[model samples]
Target: MSDLDSSTPLRSAVLHRDTHFIPKKAIGGKGSYIFLEDGTKFLDSTGGAAVSCLGHGHEGVQQAIKDQLDQISYCHSAFFGTNVTEELAQLLVDSTGGKLSKLFVVSSGSEAVEAALKLARQYFLELPAPQPDRTRFIARLPSYHGTTLGALGVGGHVMRRQPFEPLLAKNTSHVSPCYAYRGKKDGESDAEYVARLAAELDAEFQRVGPETVCAFIAEPVVGAALGCVPAVPGYFPAMKAVCKKYGALFILDEIMSGMGRCGTLHAWEQEDVVPDIQTIGKGLGGGYAPVSGILINDFIVETLDKGTGMFRHGQTYQGHPISCAAALAVQKVIKEESLLENVRNMGAYLEQQLRQHLGDHPYVGDIRGKGLFWGIEFVKDKTTKEPFDTKTRLSSLIQEKALQPEYAISLYGNPGTMDGVRGDHVILAPPYIVSKEEIDIIVDVTVKVLDEVFKGL
Candidate 1:
């Protein structure tokens, strides 16, 4: 076996995502860069999957965590609530202008999604007439929610679901995502494309017996699975209308796109519709602590309050003190520093730079995103929009090359941008504090790496 092969067990005890290649150890980080154990500094262009919004080693967030630790670190959320947790929850709700009335905190994006699924189910059960029959969920294809079974079942990422197909819930169904670059027909207008997508969703509801579906979940700006593909205009409202027509709840999974990663604090803010249940994370705690949660609309909260008066979900670390404190501090810093504005300004510059430099490249098929989150889809034939064969492993090559000492940069690369097994794209989600100069550096290095990788093709 090759040294990089997992068949040859590594010295480390931790089972990594890829046992074949042990990743560099991050010893420390500050601002937009991370320092490896061997003293190499790499620019954090993708914020570790768009998690670190405020960059790293911020004193304000660290102090908040330390303060919470000094008072109390752990507490059973069921019996007692920390002041910090309450404040954080209130802050999140208030940010939504009281539209979403309640918050249920958790430790990660997966947990938040799991809670969303359960809460969505329970919301139906808590309704005036009750919907015990509403056991199914509808989500978009080429999407991801989380790794847990319930979240995974609702998610439509084919490769992720393949191994656990037998174990996944049979109640979940998937329809086409509003991926305009590919999904939109050649002669269709944006409005027509959205209408067609809405019709597809409406048909999916009918196929699944809409009455049996509890919710329709999607990312306002599709992340990870499809490489930051936002829906065409009017897409969300049309889909939400269909869900309303079916009496199903509309859920938005914003674990990667929200929390000001997409200019607005909530990605839905840019959309015309509001989700009944919205899951948020990543940028919430800015990588200072593990934190994620669900924001519930007033209707759902009131329904439950009038019925069971409980969500009937529990986690040991729900509303964790330190996590809440760290998240609270992160939000405060964003507000104090006006980082959202920076995200908008810097995002525009990044988009302009990327398009100006890489837009016309023969291999660049599509570049789409909003705010600071952007993606570049690579193609073997630009005219045909033909993606490189999966065997090429183009995304992996770009990621590997970008991380070399000469490049000293980090990027989020993924295969299967076209479907579950084809296409490649790389995401650029620099921290909100990233400067124009840093963006130029990112674009320059990105060009170099892509050129180097594609030249041999």
Candidate 2:
């Protein structure tokens, strides 16, 4: 067997990310590794954009899915409810300590975000004093919520939103994200930085008319657009205060950073704040099935209960039984094995090892993350924190090098870490079950690849 040659046209009809860059056919995967049809195995460090938290071919999750199929595979949520779906929703609510009183299960993160936006708008309309003018949303810059139009409109990722700008809704406005790495000024204390971001949010609310906003959305740890940059201490509470003062709902998009990815069942748990609405995906089902959901706090539930007595949004696959079963099984495995503790312990080791190996590298500007989710940003001049030119494709080169036969490793690379158009960073989010030995291998191989890429620079 040989790797798929790039010179040859791809034989399949699938619309790949890059038509010219044909990838090897993955024949199988098991335990944090995927096997190409060419008999090569690559350690999955980024877990397919942080989706495969339980890793590959989990026997328990497989069994759970099969068991669910035997009982019932396809039951539309609007027509009927399955035991598995109900149980999964209950588990999610219980995990949140009942602060989030209602759940709306969807098939994917994008769908969940869309539903959350709709729910937020509906909640305001349902109030006794109907806020017909509360039609706008406040989001953070350099953030990614999802791909759907509603989700994309609220997102601030420059490259992704460029082509679709005309079609996107004009109701969403962006504010500066609490990104301390580059956004914080010299000699500025963490508290000062937090205050600055809060003031910006407050200003945005006023600029858009506080009563005109339905909700404010952000990722607890800014993903993709700016890499895994967790806000400094007291950041969330400060932002939430702004949302509350404006009489707008606070929504957290945890699609990439929740469901124990950041060492807590909910990433916001560590931030010491409770969002009015929350959307979660990726790690929620550990790649076992397509599943995501929104958690609504009591305020929304109470308002809807008293007014419409129903949520206006519905989907054909609202709560797929098998998907719910798979997610439930994935969550159960995480709890029974106590993987959150492993994430915390290994996350510290990963940060230490990354800093130890790459801290002095001329191009390594910053390394930041929490739990197993981490990002290493590259700069042309570390002292000045100047990013490489977008035309250089530095992040792409590193990703390509890491996946070569010599390294046989996987990583997530993205451009526009500094803003929407000009920065580069690579993210590494290994499975929570990763061991210290595996962490060493990941770190060592990553350093080798980086060295090879920047050797002549």
Q: Pick the candidate with the highest TM-score.
A: 2
Off by over 4 Å in 2: 1-6
Q: Each prediction's TM-score against the native?
A: 0.98, 0.98
lDDT of 2 by residue, 1-457 (tens): 2245668767768777777666778889998888887777889999989999989999999999999989999976778999998898899999989999888888898999999999999998999989999999999889999998999999999999999999999999999998888999999999999998999889888888998999999999877888899999999999899888878999999999999989999999986699999999999999999999999899899999999899999999988998999999999999999999999999999999999999998899999999999999999997889999998898888988888877988768999888899999999999988889989999999999998999845
Each prediction's whole-model lDDT (CA):
0.91, 0.91
**lDDT tens digits by residue: candidate 1, 194-269:** 8888899899989989889999999998888989898888989999999999999999999999999999999999
Q: List all candidate RMSDs to the true structure.
A: 1.7, 1.3
TM-score of model 2 (CA atoms): 0.98
Superposed model 1: Cα runs more than 4 Å off: 1-9
